[model samples]
Target: MAGLDFEPALAAALTRHVQGITSVGKLTRLSGGASQETFAFDAHTASGTLPLILRRAPGGSRDGGSGQGTALATEARAITAARACGVKAPEVVYVLTPQDGVGDGYVMERVEGETLARKILRDKEFDAVRPKLAYQCGQAMAQIHQADASQVPELRLVTGPQQLAEYYERYRAYDLPKPVFEMAFAWLKPRIKEPKRTVMVHGDFRHGNIMISPKTGLAAVLDWEIVHRGDPLEDLSWICINAWRFGVTGKVVGGFGDVPEMLAGYRDAGGDAYTVEDVRTWEVMGSLKWGIMCMGMYEVFRTGYDRSVERAAIGRRSSENEIDLVNLLIG
Candidate 1:
């Protein structure tokens, strides 16, 4: 603590609200938030040193990558609602205001788990839990879908057409052409008919965004920035997208479980009913959406807002979705 720059301001603020926090230690930035900044640290108190995360949107910065997602306040609300529906999630401890000096964001009780896509897919430690992931994902998504928007009026409702247009506009901003995107857009523009139904969706609820424990299959669902009201099946499709499979493409449901087990779990958890055909349509849309999102990150980096190698790297991976689109649509 003597040799390094210690975090006092945040520590002091946390101490006041965190109750009996004798010391706050090791304020290490874990990674960047999807639409903000994320940090991991310890709060030393009478009980023990508590591991927690700070997700901040940096006062005046544009919500990082894209403005499509919810603000920190809405994200906190979504997490609260998800927890109420019995979904495993980080308990939001505080939502910092302009006065907190830590910027606009929130602090949450960190749940320790492996969220790395490859580790969960290949690690032997997760061998047992791997088999049950898809089912668990289904059951959890049901609970997430139940988090009604009426209670959390901060969330914006987005229809299928609206979402498609939003992504299309982002893709256009890139000003680069991908024949695959064009083909996928053409095929989907007509067929992707939404029934005007809406539900709370964990927009980026997939392998990388979800945390899993080796002993328990799923630990906590993280990243609610993109939480919105949309088609319930969108969550299912997002999970099944090939980009999330992390090399185990044979198993469609996040490269660990089959679709049948997932759907069965969904049914048992009282999720909305859907057919294979319904998922097929959404999968194509999901694939394109992921591609567009990758481009959005690239745009952020390319525009000189935030220079990160990871963001630049992701821009190239959009081609992966291109191939997936071709296989799903024309093939």
Candidate 2:
């Protein structure tokens, strides 16, 4: 029931929200999300039939050490803040809080777009659209950074140095003897002196995290679990990281465009204070951070906190991509 039991409650909730709404049916879980559960459903309402998405933390049981609560709240707040800032985020219909006895979840409009990285990079239908997406990604990120932080106080959850420190602590807590990652950690400590500027960073900004339409290019930026305050360049570098290039490594900037175009777009969109050096440094950090985090996800799967074959596979991907970081630093 925990996995697919939300149907009855969801139907009741929908009925209350939409007058004369009734007969909600065909709720099914969607794939691709390992940290949380997502479902798409159709509902019969007096207004009309509707398609919606429901996102909630994985089950209702909160593992003592997994930082799931903060993550859930962070994503909900990010969706709200992004919409208020004029960013292209899915419209949030309702935020289910803990007190609601519905677990932590949210209902939103199901946006139509493709989130597959390779598909976006290879699809001929997006030939014209893809070229301009990098710049648009930059512009959208700039807008998110410019969002009033006060509206989303959760952005202050971590700062520059604390951000890196927290990741190290998480890895250490796992007690995994990762020599390469240890070296990367040592390299990151000194580099964390101070950022040139502080802004909201979409912690996991990259090609796969964005949804793009074959015709319109970037439709909306997804995955807000890691949203926090830090160097604006962190977001830029993250998108350009090689792992996200999806076989188009030579293109550099998310395989959609070049760095100059991305930087130029960000600069024109009021990110003038950002510098190339700043973004480069963060790019290195981005690679290391994601590599380590990928390992953490695998740990979660292995430890039975979450048992998903997809997560185990993702964990194995960290090593190959971390090497890219080593090369970037030494070469």
Candidate 3:
């Protein structure tokens, strides 16, 4: 799988399954996404060269991660369903089969945009698009939520209380005490409630998972690995988590726009009515969720399960989420 050696197997798959794909060119694995592997390459088709991305499990395993995510095929189906609902999700070109020999993953159109949270927030190039991203995110979430459940992949049904308990249990197992996490947990426990109706919730609908186009604002929503059926407010509140706002905490929505505007866009796009207070509750949960995730990641580092510096660095950010929880729950 070094250099261009990975091309032949992938090329064979694409040529056999993907229409017009004659061969592949320069398949390069992209960095980041620890749980999954991503590769960028060109499909030298009969008509033109096409840029596409292959996302798969780390070692071609059918089920990636420790039961944290759905199958790659399921993720691909969710993307297709989202796109069908008018959400700006990547177009799924092909789902890799075991016979393909590439891995357990799918091929999607390479969306052109910035996915880095800090770069999209601070870069001068994205300055013009910053102000509108939150609203666009709202619109996209609305479309995703409106998708027919029957049409999309079978997703796990997750409730707010269910998630809170799961994360809290994980935190307890870690045995690393944080007063902020404790306080956030106590504050969130009583408030967490299931919605009257459920919709497709993009479990991690934050800055990094969203693609931003300088000219068009929000491009496509990426990473549906943990997507599930839940309250739409979960998606709404997740973007408002202070950690996603980066250093620009004032904007309150992905470091770009205000909550009112985000809500306006959501409601305008046929999303259910939700108050700012509603979003605030879920925001608290989202902060607590992220804090626990950071802790779990740090646990990996602590146990030498993953000795990567990245794991340790992300573990250090748990305190940041603590501050966010304090601001939301205590302030």
* TM-score against native, each model: 0.90, 0.86, 0.95
* Model 1 weakest lDDT span, ten residues long: 58-67
Top lDDT prediction, candidate number: 3
Model 1 stretches with alpha carbons more than 4 Å out: 1-6, 59-66, 297-313
lDDT of 2: 0.76
Candidate 2, run of 10 with poorest lDDT: 60-69
Residue 47 shift from truth in candidate 1, angstroms: 2.4
- lDDT of each residue in 1-331, candidate 3, tens digit only: 6544657888899999988999888788885365688889999977899999988887566654357787778788878888888998889999999888877889999989898988998889998888888788888889999988776647888888888888888999999889988988888888888787888888888887898888989998998988889888889999898888888989999889998889988988988878889899889988888889899889989999899999999998998888888888778
| Model 1 lDDT tens row, 1-331 | 3312326767777887767777787777766644577788888889787888888774324343246768887799899998888889999987766665666678898888999989999999999899999999999998998886787886777877778888788788789988898888887788777754588988888977899999999888998888988888888888888988888988888989887788888888988777777787889999999888888878889998879898899988888999899889878
**For residues 1-331, what per-residue lDDT tens digits would candidate 2 score against the true structure?**
3477767877777666655668678888885354677788877767787787777777744322145334565667777887777788887776665544556777777888988888888888888798898789888888888877776775554555776888888888878788777877788788765666677777777866799998888898876766777777778888888888877878888887888888887877777555666667777777877888798889889889888788899998988766887787777
**Per-candidate count of clashing residue pairs (backbone under 3 Å):** 0, 0, 0
What is the C-alpha local distance difference test score of each model?
0.82, 0.76, 0.85
Residue 59, model 1, lDDT? 34
Pairwise TM-score winner, candidates 2 and 3: 3
